[model samples]
Target: MLINDLIILQRGADLTKIAEFKLNSFNSFFINFIALLIFSLGFALILSITGIEPWLAYIETTIYNGQILGLFATLLGVVILHELLHGLAYIIFGAKLKFGIKYLNIYTMDISGTFYTTFEMVVILLFPIFVLTGLLLISGILFPGLIYWMIIAILYNISGSFGDIFMLIIILFMGKNCKIKDEEYGFSIYT
Candidate 1:
């Protein structure tokens, strides 16, 4: 209903629907699994190149007790932070923002009345991944004691970004001045 309302309100004489996709459970799982595998391999390659063993980091962290709860809390915080980063990017680019959660999935959106260039939209979509990954890498390097947790957070965040990356790839191939209407489950693009 909300998506239909948005479609009615945003439709213009020249605007044409270029593409649409819904992120159902099956695709979401598949995409995220692939992304996680890629990110893990990449992270492992980085560690190997630097001669830094994650097992060493893990073993050291395991010596400290009660980190399970701390890790859980950190992951929860990271999910919230990831959505907030998306909202922030949308706002910075002058788009109206809305955020919501359904079941276990959390989403942040640019509601309406805003159009973005391909570059701007790509930045908005990928901003969280870039920021989180950079922070985690820097923190892990600076504070070796935190590397294990940081690595976990980085992988989790990357996996969570599957939907955004999917949308980004779609938007990249669309017209330069495409507009996006974000829904809780998916997005519709118009050009």
Candidate 2:
């Protein structure tokens, strides 16, 4: 659906383009941060509850032992590069430029103004995976110790890529006429 359509949504359009973009940015960042925290906390809780052997779970244990400064730097680097890929993909497809954000939920290109076919959509969706994978593989092979950072980068990209993955699936199966409508987290794809 288009941005104007979104304004006519059932609850009534409550946001201007700038407001919506700002809200989206805040939501994206907050959600990703909360998800990561919850994921880590739940994993830790499970391990503690199960009485896992600490030394045997050395990888898990060591992750938490990582240097805070290094972690933040790695995360910031991954996020910036990831968004840059998105922006570049938009340009390659000739889509109008839109805002980019560091946080997961808030980041989006406001290219509803332009139309793209399924193939172009696929290109946009898959660009980051292709770019980041090349970067990850090269870095991991050259400096094996950087595997952790690679993992962080890949997962970070994938977290946001879920929407693209869904888009690709629908466009492939349902054709260009397919539209994804929300019903909570999972979407309903129909003509």
Candidate 3:
């Protein structure tokens, strides 16, 4: 396995470009930060309405030891697994992928730039949030001892997905005629 301090997934545009959104841009970064808080609030509402796990359970966990350390470890694992899930969805959609750490986290790129249709790209973006949240919920329910940590991991993973969520929002209006290429910083939409 190879790791780098930074991974450059950016490539020169080889197709007609409509718009390019960048993660490092001021507007996008502001939106991403706000999106994190929005996701947290939204998911919190979902959990409360569903009552899948009592809010108290997430708070008072005397059942587990070393939760502080364990939670950090779990979050890190979830982040990597989150990226892998994105890659998995891309592969399923017949896209060639490359993995990279734009700053300090994993993001997947379609190596060929124009491999994914709008719908497929949406699936790739949303896949991890749904799958990981479901898995975490199930594990939390089954292993009551882990509910506290599992819930935190779920929230972190979801909120951490601000970039994907933002891209998905933009892509929804882009229609199915466009192709998307993932970039180290953000994404490119091609007509």
Candidate 4:
């Protein structure tokens, strides 16, 4: 059994198991769905309240003209970009990076035993959301033709990020100076 480096700690090691970030598939799905709903409602409200006619027109045109294939492609690209940002952050923080996909989940991780500081892990978690949102916004402005794709990417990116946001909340409560290892299921925090 080749467990990643952090797995060794759980298998039996010197470090105390401070916390286990157990993943719940149903919870993740539920939260992501709820987030999407809330965001959509809020965005609609803002557009209506603020009288953002341009945005309204763009969205109307997009909904009417967009194809299923384009939507899927844009969303898939956002997911790929999201994982790449995690990989980039991992490398920037001195971890050996590896990428993998299983079923619908695409991921980038440090395969070796190298664990990261809480701050480093936070950056790894959030880098994608911030960077991608910024890029999508800039692209939407610079190339109006991409507005349809950008809107889809933005919606997906924000909704997809709730998992990372949940982990961020967890990391905030973790013990100070703790080491974090990305695990298959979630995270293993060692103090």
Candidate 5:
């Protein structure tokens, strides 16, 4: 879906595109790989700090007896929930919400004309990472059997959020009070 479609759906203030960073297949892959690497390293550091043998848990693989299908279903549900959390954050910050899928990837946008503070936008972008990781970590601690799935979910969600993290880094350097319009592949920030 185009931004115009979102404008029509929201029927709210007009947003002018100030800057856009488009992500093609190669760039997206590279960014996601970097994100995965960083997140994994950070997680390993945390484990080490807590006196856990990171290498042992990291290398151990669990065999799925008859739960392969269930695992995939749960993964799909988690992916959808991740996008919904993005939309929820946008809504919480008083922005109109629109969701769409492009090239089999799902995305949510805040299309309102409200110019958000740098702190607000950063919180919106990082909200899913915080919420999802927190839940998965808690689940892993409470249910030993679900530890494998929890780790996978946390890693997948963090890696998938590469684009948001990239955008946040860019927005951090921009002036305060910049209006942001989220698109499927990227976002525009106007001063």
Candidate 6:
């Protein structure tokens, strides 16, 4: 099948394969979760100990009573925009989107079964970094009270984007042989 016609086998067509896929993905998700948690907590602690509050944090806690709500809203907006960029980029580059595949054990998920080019994935991966930065800048100026939440949201995006960046690095290193594996034995084979 062409990359454009790809589909993720949610159940893997058999119990053994299904169990294997789940186990592999579960392990990956667990490691990612722990890494993200530790990194984020450590970074936040450093900020606290150094008395280096981001400008947004000061404004958020000081002025508005609804600051918490604003932060939550901004965070939700950031995540939605990030995923949308990926899906849209896939579509624009001639790929179709299957259901998003969230690893039940992790805070992140895959945009499952997307039919896009390597170049398409790269662009999609970078899109949110730029887009989110622009949004943060504009929102910071327009709504200072949401700054703390915005910082958290940006950090979250960057942490997740780390893997995408690494994926791109491997693709570049491996040349055209780069493909996201769906399984060890039954990957969505790419040419």
Per candidate, the number of residue pairs that clash is 0, 4, 0, 1, 0, 0
Please give the lDDT score at residue 165 for candidate 2.
63
* Candidate 3, position 91, lDDT: 85
lDDT of 6 by residue, 34-122 (tens): 65985588567757865676654665554575556665676577667777766666566555444343443222224344333456657
Off by more than 4 A, model 2: 1-66, 100-104, 110-112, 177-191
Query: Once model 2 is optimally superposed onto the true structure by TM-score, how far is the C-alpha of residue 74 displaced, in angstroms?
Result: 1.6
Structural similarity to truth (TM-score) of each candidate: 0.76, 0.56, 0.74, 0.78, 0.71, 0.60
Residue 44, candidate 4: alpha-carbon lDDT: 78
User: Tens digits of per-residue lDDT for model 5 on 67-158?
Assistant: 66666776787788888888888888877887776655577876554556677888898999899889889988999877867776777777
Query: How many times do residue backbones clash in model 4?
Result: 1
lDDT of each: 0.77, 0.56, 0.74, 0.77, 0.72, 0.54
Off by over 4 Å in 4: 1-14, 49-68, 101-104
Candidate 6 is scored at a TM of: 0.60
Give per-residue CA lDDT, model 4, range 1-191, as digits (tens): 46554576564475676887755667556666776786687567656765788776866776788665677888889989998988888889777777776433566767666677888888999999999999999999999988757866887788778778877888778865888887765778887
The local distance difference test score of model 6 is 0.54
Tens-digit lDDT track of model 2 for 1-191 = 56655543632332222111123455455656655765466556656765667424545645687755676787677666766786788788655555543434434463434444556667776898788868877887898766655655665665555555645765577666443332222224333
For candidate 3, lDDT tens digit of each residue in 85-181?
A: 9989988976677887644446777764444678888799999999999999999999998876787788887787777877788877776788777
Worst 10 residues of 6 by lDDT: 12-21
RMSD of 4: 4.1
- Give the least accurate 10-residue stretch of model 5, judged by summed lDDT: 55-64
For model 6, the stretches where C-alpha displacement exceeds 4 angstroms are 1-24, 34-42, 45-70, 105-116, 176-189
Off by over 4 Å in 3: 1-15, 25-28, 39-65
Winning candidate number (TM-score): 4
For all the candidates, what are their Cα RMSDs to the real structure?
A: 4.3, 9.2, 6.5, 4.1, 5.3, 6.9
Where's the lowest-lDDT run of ten residues in candidate 1?
4-13
